[model samples]
Target: MSDRITIKFNAAQFLTSAPTLKHCPPDTGAEVAFAGRSNAGKSSAINTLTQQKKLARTSKTPGRTQLINFFTLGEEQTRLVDLPGYGFAKVPLEQKLEWQKHLAKYLEERKSLKGLVLVSDIRHPLQEFDRMMIQWAEDSQMPLHILLTKADKLKKGPAKNTMLDVKRALKDFQGEASVQTFSALKKEGLDQLKSRLTEWLTPDEADQAIEELIDQDSE
Candidate 1:
């Protein structure tokens, strides 16, 4: 596979509001969205997965990414969505409500959204808000995957055990959802997360993927 299978995030268009999201092109390309609490290392994880510096900007400031960001994954024409982080610190209620409205509408209605990559803190697996979001994704039938960020902060045994605890908590949701320990700082789990993301690329873009499997089988 091409290293550019994930490309530079060439554009970060800031739509004024969620209602304007309808104006986006309705192309059939696969879309993998990333969402987590503000400052939960979403941008860093994206950068690590794509192996591109600054594809998504990391920030200590809560709620720096206040709009939906889009990027193409090179020649195969995959779409990656960087959603605005929810639950920012010290934000006004009205602004939070506005972001929530936009994000909820997009998740519930986007036809081309093939999957969602939900990032969360490894130490606290399922906060109530995260659980509610998982239920929503489950109801929407979207293929879901969890990126347990900050894995490097914990010891290996504790990290693996925490992952299992998370998986056990997800048994009810549908689709092939799985959890992977990740740390953009440590560069841990980047390759594994990228491999999981490969499953989200549009079926058409996955042709050589099938052929490669066949070649392996033939050998």
Candidate 2:
């Protein structure tokens, strides 16, 4: 849809946290996930996207979100996941390995995971962990929407170039992966983010909403 769908961010509420796949909530409905490096502003992006401050618990400390936290959008079936950040050097080796294992299993095996919103810092772009995530999405044939967060840190020209560069890098990927610049601090790209989430989490509803809008325009 060309027009952005209005999202009720306050509708989002904390669901549950699962340390491992076995402990996750039931795999019954469509859910989109957010993943990124520890210092990638993942939590800021989530809070900004949902229009709810402290929804995902933004922290100055990296690797603070060690669990896979779930947030539902009014409905229990529709969900948004905050995955533990990867590539944190300060975290213990054993714990880092454990997080990796859990993340890999969930990405590869979660039936309810419709798509992923891979958040990356625009300044740093794609790191090693981000490439691994891209590989996983490619192998699974899952749709991926990349968010170049902290775009405000860069000038307009550099931000645009970064988005283009990332898109080019992902061109060789087998699965669908889209890239866009985002600035949680400036509230940029919220509309686009919400629109993508709508398409992924509630495709039918999105279509119906588009149809309704078109009808209104005609009338």
Candidate 3:
């Protein structure tokens, strides 16, 4: 079995915000991106995952995150990206289109992107924009993990049913796809999220050994 590195998500720090793909940091190392519609609890889930109250900046107003925000983990090269929330942002049509263009460019061309975490409200899983994202991921053959946020709002049975329904819906997706219920308020399903991220972000055993050796030499 291959060894895995434990990621320290609490150590995550704000890296930078890029308005477009061209302004993003160098395309090196692995990164996972989080995308969701406005008011989908995406920021809250990120904050919960990082064990920070305001890591991703939660606001009562929907669509406060306008740029592609990047956060660095314990490893400088490893990163978590927050893509701009789509649909329901109170921006002009031209601005929304511009944002979509940049978002598409990043998703299509970012070489360092290892996977995408698509957040949705558990009560309203797979909205119009959500399905579009899933389709895009399928077309690009990108690994997609769906987080049905706000699961605490529903009863246990409903939550499980919603998750199961989502899983069934995605069975036809040709690419790697998965769905899980999550609740930032309750920190429910946090461990599962971390496990998925670790699987995507952790380097292989050989790479880890090399990195360990480099660190030891530096020390």
Best by lDDT: 3
Better of 2 and 3 by lDDT: 3
The residue-by-residue lDDT of candidate 3 on 53-131, one tens digit each, is 8899977778878999999998768999999896687889899888878888888899889999999999888999899
Note the Cα lDDT for every prediction shown. 0.76, 0.87, 0.91
Candidates sorted on TM-score, descending: 3, 2, 1
lDDT against true structure, model 3: 0.91
lDDT for 214 (candidate 3): 85
Looking at model 3, the pairs that clash are none
Clashes of each: 0, 0, 0
Each prediction's Cα RMSD?
Answer: 6.8, 6.4, 3.6
Candidate 2 stretches with Cα past 4 Å from truth are: 1-7, 205-219
After superposition, which runs of candidate 1 have C-alpha atoms over 4 Å from their true positions? 1-20, 204-219
Question: Distance from true position, residue 215, model 3, in Å?
Answer: 17
lDDT of 1 by residue, 1-219 (tens): 454354333333222222336755464556788888876678888887777777788877778778788776663346778888865657788888887777777888887787889889898777765776688688778888999999999999999999999999988777668889999888999778777777566354466687579789999
Measured against the true structure, the TM-scores of the candidates, in listed sequence, are 0.81, 0.88, 0.91
